[model samples]
Target: MSGIRAVADGLVDELKRSLPQQRKTQRGNLALLVATMLEVRSANLMDLAASLPREADRTDMRYQWIARTLSNTLIDPDAVMAPFAAEVLERAAADPDGIVLILDQSKLSDRHQVLMLAVRHGERALPLAWRVEATAGAIGFATQKELLGVVAPWVPAGAAVCLMGDRFYGTADLIALCQRRGWDYRLRLKGTLTVRDSSGRTTTAARAKSKDFYLEDVELTARRAKTNIGIIHDPGHAQPWIIAMSDNPGYGTTLAYSERWGIEPMFSDFKSRGFGIDNTQLRYPDRLARLILVMALALYSAVSTGHWDEVHHPTPAEKNI
Candidate 1:
């Protein structure tokens, strides 16, 4: 058998084990598509169809089959991703430093934006959940809350989770969501946001001096959500890092905002670097979201395989040096 077929067969068994409720035909089709994507490393339907191991003689027939799978409303991305996400959270919960979840958005095309939530693993991150919208602007807090709500139950009870996000996500609503879920956060604040300190003195976050500083017990903006603010203005950067955290503010706590960068590499993998998903011509938001689900499954499979290999069969350099 071809290597792609071999991989697909293995994936079929794994998917059956994880998603037993799914129809066998659905699971088999998904496995073949994911295996083909790993081999072609592209999201162009034609490229994927060309590599897909199917009984159909015509490439167009294969392409239509792939499209039908993506367009199937019965296939829920959340249900497909839950098993993989559960394992990721389980491992993270075992760590002493706890799980780091990063929230961000990226443009998929002229018509679509993907709001993604990812879990930090090693130097990169793995997809946790995502929502695709047909808008150029932010996906908004309602959608953000919905996405977080989906992943909240998958987290192990009492697991330490610190969510990190850029300025777009640093809002009173998101902080309130984190507080309600009993998760920690390191969300960056916009410099123009109104902040009132413990002394009742009101000022903008940008009013702080060009040096590292911490503000405790500050009420942020008109909503007056209580949080600790951490500011770090290094020598060359144009803007300082104004981070809000649930913990006591300090240099180290503020600098933990850097962990949010882990999501960037995962975005690249979905775009030009790995799958070239941005090249896809699919315009329907739901179909594109399903395609992202395929990519997410492929990524989780690759990462899990690599980790297993590293543990059972390390390289000579890894074994020695």
Candidate 2:
């Protein structure tokens, strides 16, 4: 076990330990090489091999050997990374403020891509989950559901939970699901959709007229927002109206949905310089997850060491769990 083989071996074992069920890939090498290359920000196999230790540099012995070991063997990366999500998110949920679960997806290359990652906000990228978004397209529901299940336990019993998401998630099903589970949700709804009230009554007064009827209009600047009546006459059928589903209603109810954007800068950091998530060349989803896991581990190290905020020189920053 030379090259990154030992380090790879340890990582594989660590990942397995975090899993609920036993994993089969114990002596991984090529998989390890792939993970390393992806993390090194390099493209192509030859360049990846360059990072291999000289002692284990044999194309067949180290890299190929590791690959042959995993060939045809089946193991979902989600199953492996699930525990890590539970470990990290559960901690966030335990915080006094509780964790702000930001739901968003990051696209890799659109040209024949595989995985879509949902990462936590802040200078540190606490990965929530990775899914095979190429097959599902845009936002992945199955992956998000599985990830939420994993993190649910980490949230203390009766802790205040706030889930933030984008307009892609503006659906009655998701909203009802979160409410049924007793989690406080902040989701951005597309103004075009018609809203149905709980009284078993529906009205299209907003839809038959204004395009942005049922949706609320809020303009935010820096730290504050100004509320106003929105006239969405640009698109299809809709009526101008404002809407919100709060524990109790008031001003800024709909405006609070914008809080999820705070996580947007974090996504930029991962794709731009921190990790090569958006620029991945890996063909397999499992490999993609592995690469992301390593980068997330690096991010976790930064968050633990207070490196992300200090390195980037933020005015005031909070430590990410």
Candidate 3:
């Protein structure tokens, strides 16, 4: 068998173990597509069809097959991703520091945006849940809430989770949701938001200056959502880090906001660096979301393979010099 077919066979076996209820044809198609993606490292239909290990004589036939798979509404992205996401969350929950979840949004094309929730792994993140919308602006809090609601039950019971997000996600509604879910968070707030401390001192977050300052039990914005504020303005940065936390604010707690950068690299992997998903001609949001699912599964498989390889065959840099 060719290397691509070999990898596809392995993925088929793995998917079968995880998704026993999935139809055999669906599972095989998904596995083949994922393996083809890993090999081609692109989302271009022609490129993928050209390398597909299918019996179809014409490349166009194979391309149509891939399109049909993506267009099939029956293939639910959430259901397909559930087992993989559970494994990621289980591993993250095992860590003493507990699970760190990152939330962010990125532009997929001229008209599509993807709001993603990912679990931190090493220096990057693995996709947990996401919603792709056909919009030019932000995917609002309603969709954000819906995405979180879907993933909330999948988290291991009693596992500590710290949710992190950039300024776009630092809304009162999101804060309330995090509070309700009992997840610790370090969401960065916009400098313009109203902040009233316990002493009833009112000011904008932009006014917070000095090396580091912590405001305990503060009410944020017109909605007056209660939270703790951690402000950090280190040298050379253009803007201060105005972070909202569920616990007492401190330097370490405020600095935890840096972990949100993990999602940036993951986005790059999905776009330019690895899969080149943005270059694809997929315009329909549903089909685009299914395409992302293919990329997500391919990424999980690649990361898992690399981890196994590193442990069994250490690189020179990992070995004692």
Candidate 4:
């Protein structure tokens, strides 16, 4: 574990070096906090403290300090998050396929909901930004747009960006936002949406024929607005998809939608798969939200290490569990 601790410490130092001048005071505590998360592989403060290096301080006072750092309002989530998000986007931009951004939400508990915007990298969707909504049901349209706002600017100029989400994220405002920003989007519309066809005729998605169709300047009767969109239905599946965009879409729309499932593995890693976030007793929305930043940094560290191993040690990597 000494090697792991040493590496985590180096990573923590790198994180502090990227922080804004005003946040310098948090360097020591933040480094210790993040290093512990890497070692414990859990978001629970108690678990992290118990797993700290044996030579380091491990008193109850230390545990209390860890709790304070997580719950403190002075610790800016954006400052903790922006550098990591930028790093992920910069890597994605280097790829000719550009980057894929996924928008989704999951429940942490009965009352706590986590809204996340992540960048898809192979099997995992690395979180770029997130918000914790206290409401019990789906988040509102305004909140969904706000989450996108946080992630959109991170994308580099001329980098092809693809934004994807499920039916819950298919609101008119979101589609319009994507259009205004000139980014390609593939969203799943609800089966009940009434959309106009290329021939200026309207039909519900549930009743629409199972074929690929493109329409320009079409009206969505349910939303009462006109937009260009593509509709595709897999003959083998029962549900058809209404893809809203400003340009022509083809079979690629279905392919892009399939990638949206990548986020499912990410959520699992945060809970049952890796960190025990689902088992945490933290209930206050603000505290839980702060804790998510810690989790994000830890996740980034794990992914970065995995990528390095995959590149340098191909033989061992091939023997997958």
Which predicted model would earn the best TM-score? 1
User: Per-residue lDDT of 134-212 in model 1, one digit per residue for the tens?
Assistant: 9999889999999999999899998999999999999999998898888899999888888886456555455466342
The Cα local distance difference test for each model comes to 0.91, 0.52, 0.89, 0.75
- Candidate 2 global Cα RMSD: 8.1
Query: Which of the two, 1 or 3, has more TM-score?
Result: 1
Clashes of each: 0, 7, 0, 0
Off by over 4 Å in 2: 1-47, 58-76, 111-125, 140-143, 196-245, 251-253, 269-272, 307-321
For each of the candidates, the C-alpha root-mean-square deviation to the true structure, in angstroms, is 1.4, 8.1, 1.9, 3.5
Judged by TM-score relative to the true structure, which candidate is superior, 1 or 2?
1
* lDDT accuracy of residue 196 in candidate 1: 80
Candidate 2 TM-score, true structure as reference = 0.64
lDDT of 4 by residue, 231-267 (tens): 6776797767777665565666555678788899989
Q: Which pairs, if any, clash in model 1? A: none
Q: State residue 134's C-alpha deviation in candidate 2, in Å.
A: 2.7
> TM-score for every candidate vs. truth?
0.97, 0.64, 0.95, 0.87
Model 4 spans with C-alpha error above 4 angstroms: 1-5, 20-25, 53-60, 197-201, 206-213, 310-321
Ranking by lDDT: 1, 3, 4, 2
- Least well predicted 10-residue stretch by lDDT in candidate 3: 203-212
Residue-wise lDDT of candidate 3 within 46-110, one digit each (tens)? 99999999999999999999999999888899998899998889999999989999989999988
| Residue 238, candidate 2: alpha-carbon lDDT | 46
Off by over 4 Å in 3: 198-201, 209-212, 315-321
